[model samples]
Target: MKTPLTSFAGLDLLTSAVIVLDAEGSILFANASAENLLDSSFKSLTHLKLTDLFLNGEELIEVFHQAVAHQFADKRQDLTLERAGREALHVHSIVTALDNPDTPVLIELRENVQQLKLDREERMLDQSKANKELIRNLAHEIKNPLGGIRGAAQLLELELPERHLRELREYTQVIIKEADRLQTLVDRLLAPHRLPHIVGDVNIHEVCERVRSLIVAEFPQGLTIKRDYDLSIPEFRGDKEQLIQTVLNIAHNAAQALHERIRQGDAVLTFKSRVVRQITLAKVRYRLALDLHIIDNGPGIPPEIRNRIFYPLVSGKEGGSGLGLTLAQTFVEQHLGVIECESRPEYTDFRILIPLP
Candidate 1:
């Protein structure tokens, strides 16, 4: 009585959007989101070609052809389509290979490209300004108290008697130690702004390989770091050290989060690289982009706080400072790149998109 599509109807209802298209780019099914966005029913869309949804239908058909060709070779392309009565939506259509080549279907992720562009740029500008303010306040407000506490500790240590000295010394030691700790925190907080960028023509794989070796050396037990790179990518110009630090920080966090699994003896951290064309991030359009992904099998980020993870001082870990990702983002932004995170219970992926030459 129930069909495969019928069985997935519940899932389709739950998703933000889901639509199925045949090999010829004609809609086979459309979910609620698609219906609402398109302002039409499945019956109408099913009878029309996919290109009909876009204003520039003919040009879009060619783009779809190019997308299918790339997918045939196991690659992906960025696609933009503008609807007649609604705003334009950007889509990344992926074609799945099947024994029946003509019946191959394409899964498309449609989103508001213009809004995402504006949001990304606004967030970057706001974050850069906030970081500058944080550094200035940290250097002034936090540093003065820290120095006084450390200085007072030495002065107090001189006035105590031998028997009572240990107790007073311990008290002073606490203040001194806490002050020193804050000093270290302050230094790291201001690091990205203070450090000079070493710009040059550097290969991205070299950066990934360097971080992999460093991580493996520290946690060589059960955690595995794997790489999947596209060799045809050309060398990109950027600050090599900053890139290393940015990647190392994210990779280290993934390794630490995999402690339980690593102790149980099966944890994997994968580094994947590919080339993307006509990609946009932070309001700037790039002809090409270098896509780097850091994937792990450990328990993913908690859903409740995933959206706020990139904010400064927002940490999900018990003893974590939470500045690692903030610093990583700052460094990446300097090189005209953006990093995005997506996670579920079993999988967590950190995607870094950098502009290419």
Candidate 2:
């Protein structure tokens, strides 16, 4: 059974903080969960401007006014709201205007961060477990077959007549090359999982710098790796080698994808890092986060396979094994981080977010 709206004094969902405000920005109705979140009751908070309740109240009110006036099409905005105990909230706001414009009511929803924190930990654990299973199956099923293929190709090379041997050798060489290629891919896919994280104080900028130099050395003529770094971020404990590999894989993929643009002398790969506080990813929450964005000015990811881009062996490039980003994702998730891709024509950005120590 469910509580009726007339009898139910609190919000039905524990996951969100729901509040109903009039066009004048007066707090008209708050469900029980919202009261619990704001640390105030409807009786005392009625007719009070929401901004007056916190440090950034004025800005919040201004955004709310603009949202209502414009009949805001975007459901997302950066907000700093507060709860009753004066706990500062860094949240993403989703606002909806009521049908009646004269008495338009706004709904502001906030996530219950305590649960978000717990969910993050759980998600990290789950990702680690899944990665282990993936590596194990792929290594046994895909890697183990390479040796036989290469051996068979070698045997076939010796059996052909000398006059026809050139073509036969070419065919054998193709088989051996492809088998070796697959072998290298399997090694890369399983590399992160096999090595223990060598945790030490690491300067993230140094890691980025190393990747930049490597990319420049490989593509000296046309491609350029640009740095847009926030140098103020302090050193944190992490595996220096793993971080290098994690970033190298993504940048390498981007470089390879920009081959045409590089030839045309317009290729650009940008690395940007910033400190973010109170982030929620994959439905989990974190107190402090580091956001690193890898942007490339190239053709965007194809729409049909964009959602499945992160899966193992899924590549947008011909001759690509598609395990580079997968391994990078595995390495990052080992550090309780996430890698997400957003691509559009003329621009593609791969954003990596990790918790700050």
Highest-scoring model, TM-score: 1
Q: Candidate 2 at residue 215, lDDT?
A: 92
Candidates in order: C-alpha RMSD to true structure: 10.5, 13.0
Q: Report the C-alpha lDDT of model 1 over 129-218, residue by residue, as the tens digit.
A: 676687678667887788888888888888889999876788888888888999998888878878998889978889999999999999
lDDT against true structure, model 1: 0.78
- The candidate that wins on lDDT is 1
Reference-based lDDT, residue 43, model 1: 78
Each candidate's TM vs. the true structure? 0.69, 0.60
lDDT, candidate 2, 144-222, per-residue tens: 7789989988998988899999877988999999999888777877777688889999888999999999999999989
Candidate 2 lDDT for residue 64: 69
The Cα error of candidate 1 at residue 95, in Å, is 27
In order, what lDDT does every prediction score?
0.78, 0.77
